[model samples]
Target: MNSPMFTRTSQQESAIQTNKVLRNTYALLSMTLLWSALVAGVSMAMNLPRPNIIIMLVGFYGLLFLTEKNRNNSMGLVFTFLFTGFLGYTTGPLIGAYVSADMGDLVVTALGGTALSFLAASAYALTTKRDLSMLGGLMLSLFVVLVVGMVASIFFQSPVLSLALSSLFIVFSTMAILMTTQGIIRGGETNYISATITLYVSIYNLFISLLSILGIMNDD
Candidate 1:
């Protein structure tokens, strides 16, 4: 049996640890995002060609796997940056295409929209401090549906359907941000490196999805 003083000390320690993890996660997230943005800018400036679909798939999955495997140590930090940088490089071609088409405003608008959505979702989760574990199953189901839709689009070559998938991805990313933030605040996520990676991926997807929708709408 624990004494009252011991219980209080334990609770305080837990809270401190949780706060530390949250702080570290956000700090690392900010740095990784800046790094990614720099790489994307360079890639865009050089007009770098996008990687082939197969290369993109393998690089993304491989880096993600490495990051997860090393997530408890400094190696996770290195892998996380590499993964985000790779994603940013892939994004450069799409952004360059939009710029070349004189749709730079669309890209800017998409960036603004992504920022706003992330802030809104994060704020709600942090302020309410509600448990979002229930969203886990729902998010997983939506992800499967999203993957299926994407595969179908590749085969069908339907612009209309591709646009629809972008819209769905935007929704999915929003929910992901909310659930991830809530998980951190509720002590469900302890590792800052893994949490940062998850949030970064959601943000990356959010930006890409928004950019796709904006480009399609502008083109139409």
Candidate 2:
């Protein structure tokens, strides 16, 4: 059996490691977000055509898989930026559409909302010691439902259903932020790269969903 001092020292070391991971994750996440924004801005200025849905889906999932598979190495960081840049590029057409429609203000508003929501969720998770692990299963279920709803709405094209799905995605994204933050604090997520990717994707979805709702509401 270990002495009390040994156990105490081990705990302290673990705490330090967790803090380092958290700090690195946040640092990388900020840089990736800025990089993504820059790419999106360039894409918008070029007025690039949006990739087809099939192409978008393939690129997203393929890059995401590569990122996760390499999360322990430098390649993870490379793939993370690639995946995020791809996503940002894909969003450029939507931004162009909103600007063309003279609804640019709505994009700003949605971005503000997404940022505020993320801060709130992250703060609560950090300040509270509550174990958010229980939320994992529930979040997974909600995610599946959200995906099904999104796919169905694509086919049915009902405004009410689409709005409801957007609302659901907002909730899912907020909970995901909370869960991801808590996972890091609890040391369940040891890899900062994976954590950054998860949080980035959540924020990305949150912004897109909010923008969709705003666009629908402002439709003339």
Candidate 3:
């Protein structure tokens, strides 16, 4: 029963809303990335040890839960920063170890690779007309597999398993970036906070995965 004009107007409004969410998500993501980097630098300077795995899991999941619960409010931003800062603190010790061992170039290479991958994935997502929502279920399945593999690697302490996990992470993170960006554009995701968190986590995983792969290669 809607007129053509009305339908057009609705589409325009939807597009505007989508654009706004995308802009806000990217802006907040940039700030959080900078904040996380600063926290990591401080942790490195202090030579802070990485927290135990149990503590790391509790902190990460707890903060993530809080952020999702507060996604509609201003507190979401606070929790987002806390979540990212916590991750930065965890990463600092790893980076410090690499630097201490004269593997600083590996970190730089991983960082560059991560950035390039993100940009390429994002650009493709934005331009592609294909629906990416179908990827959601597959991504979830991959995530479960990833978690199991990570736990197995922890107990077995196998370099081969670790390397395989790292490669899988790279694939998973790239797909995540593409899927998240397309979800934002297609109106599947409306909350900028949630969108930003997804992208940030993807980027973080990409960097960590690349770093792990590079480190393994260097060791051989």
Candidate 4:
């Protein structure tokens, strides 16, 4: 009998399909990341300052959200890449400052750690096929708290508060990794694009949080 869901394909064919999806995801991810770095470099060359951070950050989020919501088409990929590039430009000042600092190399270290952690999380999720949908609400709440905390900190400007937030973000990002990993494993076949975006965000935010922590510790 023919299945309504997926056709009964041979193991080799299934493997080929899975590999193709993964390959496209990785290729797009890598290309976008490279473009992001290039954009950051070009922005710096144009003498863009960090004080313009708010506009860049807000714009990136706003546009990315809108773009990603409609990201199933070609335009979605274009916006995703553009959003990533803007994010790189926004983060470049921080990256530059971090490198200029005495312990700036910590950024690179955090990046390596984040990469390893992301890989491990994804691999585990793919193998286990466990559902992590439970984390959706929790993750949403965490982000809300972080956003509120940041707004409050504008007036507070307490280094201690900043440290606490950085630490919390680092922890929360790690948790997000788990949720995304599980989703990737359980639903990888159904929506590879969404899964790829989810995984990319998890890794990117993890690196940012780790960078925050490293930069903070260096400041102290």
Candidate 5:
């Protein structure tokens, strides 16, 4: 049964509303990226070190957790954007490498492709009637796999493993978007604002990972 919070008069109307959530999610995702880009530029200009970056991520996540824990307060969006900016600043290292002219085009291409792919996948999940709840378990399991793969990568250093992981990364990223969108449909995600922010962050990280894959594949 659909939660009355997100239920509509009919299935058609319910789908329409779900699409609205997706649309809102996409809109916020773009703005979040823009904010992140601006922060990246600043971090690079300031020559932030790895420790500083790590601190920023830790602090940013801490604040996000704190604010989200108190989300009933009026400062939720403020906290969200603040944490997003910090996340972008922390992302400086990944993007700072591409500050050179050579990888710029590839980065843009990868980012665009990732965004489009995520959008399409989320849209499919929204428009279709398929149940994606199973993906939740897959999402959790992927993290364990991802962590184990990272540990194994240190010793193996095999290109095959990296390639396989890249493929799995893309698959899991798409599934993240799919599950989030379906959560909206099933009334599993109650807070639209938080849902949109969570989805936006997932897609942003997906873009980063996709760019890394593309850059490595091209040996650039």
Candidate 6:
């Protein structure tokens, strides 16, 4: 019953809305990244110890849940910051250890690599015409495999496994960036908050994975 003009207008409106969400998501992502870095700097300056694993996991998942639960409200922003800040705090001790061990350059290298990977992935996603929504299932499968590997590595204490997992993480994180960005552009992701979280998590994992790989290589 809709006229051609009406359909065109609806498409235009949807495009505008998608653009707005993408812009907002990037803005919020930048702020959260800066905030997280600042918190990490403070933690490093104080030489804070890494938090216990159980507490860190609990806090992370709990805040993530709260953020998702409140995604439609202003409270989601609050929870988002809380979640990222906690991650930053946890990252500080790891960075500090590297610096204290005179491996600061390794950290810088990892940072640079992570940034480049993200930019490459995002640019590809933006420019490509191919549909990436099909990657959803693949990404989820890889994530589950990674989680299992991580848990097994923890118990097995195998450096080879650790290195392999880090490599896989890099691949997973890059695909995640591509998939999430394409989703935003394709109108599959309407919530800026959720999009920001996904992108932030991708970037965070990319950085950590790069750091781990670099550290391992440097030690060898």
> Could you say which candidate leads in lDDT?
3
Ranking by lDDT: 3, 6, 2, 1, 5, 4
> Candidate 4: lDDT of 178?
73
RMSD vs true structure, all candidates: 1.1, 1.0, 1.1, 3.3, 4.4, 1.1
What is the C-alpha lDDT profile of model 3 across 118-170, one tens digit per residue?
Answer: 99999999999998878889889988999999889878988899899999998
Question: How many collisions per candidate?
Answer: 0, 0, 0, 0, 0, 0
Poorly placed runs, candidate 2 (over 4 Å): none
**Candidate 1 per-residue C-alpha lDDT over 1-220 given as tens digits, one digit per residue, 9 for 90 to 100:** 9999999999999899889988999999999999999999999999999999999999999999999999988899889999999998998888899889888888899899989998998899899845778888988999999999988987898768979898888888888888878888888889999889889998998899888877677763
Per-residue CA lDDT of candidate 5, range 1-220, in tens? 7776555457667667766766666686677778878987898778785456357557767877865775556577677777787777777766767755468777788779887998798779878898898888988999789879967987997877877777777888788888887888777765666776677667776777777687778775
What's the TM-score of every candidate structure? 0.97, 0.97, 0.97, 0.80, 0.78, 0.97
Per residue, candidate 6 scores C-alpha lDDT tens digits across 1-220 of 9999999999999999999999999999999999999999999999999989899889999999999999999999999999999999999999999999999999999899989998999999999999988888988899899999989997998878989999999888888899889999999889999999989999999999999988888873
Query: Higher-lDDT candidate among 1 and 3?
Result: 3
The local distance difference test score of model 2 is 0.91
C-alpha lDDT of all candidate models, in order = 0.89, 0.91, 0.93, 0.70, 0.75, 0.93
- Lowest lDDT sum, 10 consecutive residues, model 3, at 211-220
Which residue segments of model 1 deviate by more than 4 Å? Answer: none
- Which is the better candidate, 3 or 5, if ranked by TM-score? 3
**Span of 10 residues, lowest total lDDT, candidate 5:** 49-58
Query: What lDDT is obtained when candidate 1 is compared to the true structure?
Result: 0.89
Cα TM-score of candidate 3: 0.97
Query: Model 4 off-target regions past 4 Å?
Result: 1-20, 44-47, 51-53, 188-193
- What range of 10 consecutive residues in model 6 has the weakest lDDT sum? 211-220
